[model samples]
Target: MQRTTISVSGMACDGCEQNVETAVETLDGVNRVEADHTADTVEVVRADDVADDDLHAAIERAGYDVSA
Candidate 1:
């Protein structure tokens, strides 16, 4: 498995965190996801085949910005 921590923006509350988590968890290779609005970060544990671009896209689709 691969663990990745991504910086994110526009998460204002727990619901926003859940939104990001839910979005990323939908990815095929994603094993787990934890999003923290307070820190503006999202941590993902996923299969090695999961690409960073996919994660970023998922978060973006959830109405957030993934920081590089």
Candidate 2:
């Protein structure tokens, strides 16, 4: 599995964190997702085939912004 850490904006509470986690977990080959509102980041454990664009899109779909 490959681990990726991406910063997410607009995560102001636990609910937002859960939203980010749920969104990322929906992707194929995503093994795990841990989102931290406090840290404003999402850590994804997924297969190598997972694309960065997919991750960014998932975060956006969750109503959050991905920081570059």
Candidate 3:
């Protein structure tokens, strides 16, 4: 498994964090997801086949801004 952490904008509460986490967890290679609105960050534990872009897109699709 690979762990990736990325900063995100627009998360204001625990529900926002769950939204991001749920979105990322839907990806095929994602093993786990943890999003913290208080910290404005999302951490994903995924399989080797998961690409960074996939994570970015998943977060964005959930309506958050991801830092590069």
On TM-score, the stronger of 1 and 3 is: 1
| Candidate 2 residue pairs that clash | none
| Candidate 2 per-residue lDDT over residues 1-68, each given as its tens digit | 89999999999999999888999999999999999999988999999999999999999998999999
lDDT score of model 1? 0.96
What are the lDDT scores of the predictions, listed in order? 0.96, 0.93, 0.92
- Rank the models by TM-score, top first: 1, 2, 3
In candidate 1, what residue range of length 10 has the lowest lDDT sum? 29-38
2 or 3, greater by lDDT: 2
Query: Model 3, which residues run further than 4 Å from truth?
Result: none
Q: 1-68 in candidate 3: lDDT tens per residue?
A: 99889999999998999899999999998988999888889989999999999899989999999987
User: TM-score, each model?
Assistant: 0.98, 0.97, 0.95
lDDT winner, 1 or 3: 1
Show model 2 residue runs off by greater than 4 Å. Answer: none
lDDT of 1 by residue, 1-68 (tens): 99899999999999999999999999998999999999999999999999999999999999999998
TM-score of 2: 0.97
Task: Give lDDT: candidate 2, residue 14.
Answer: 92
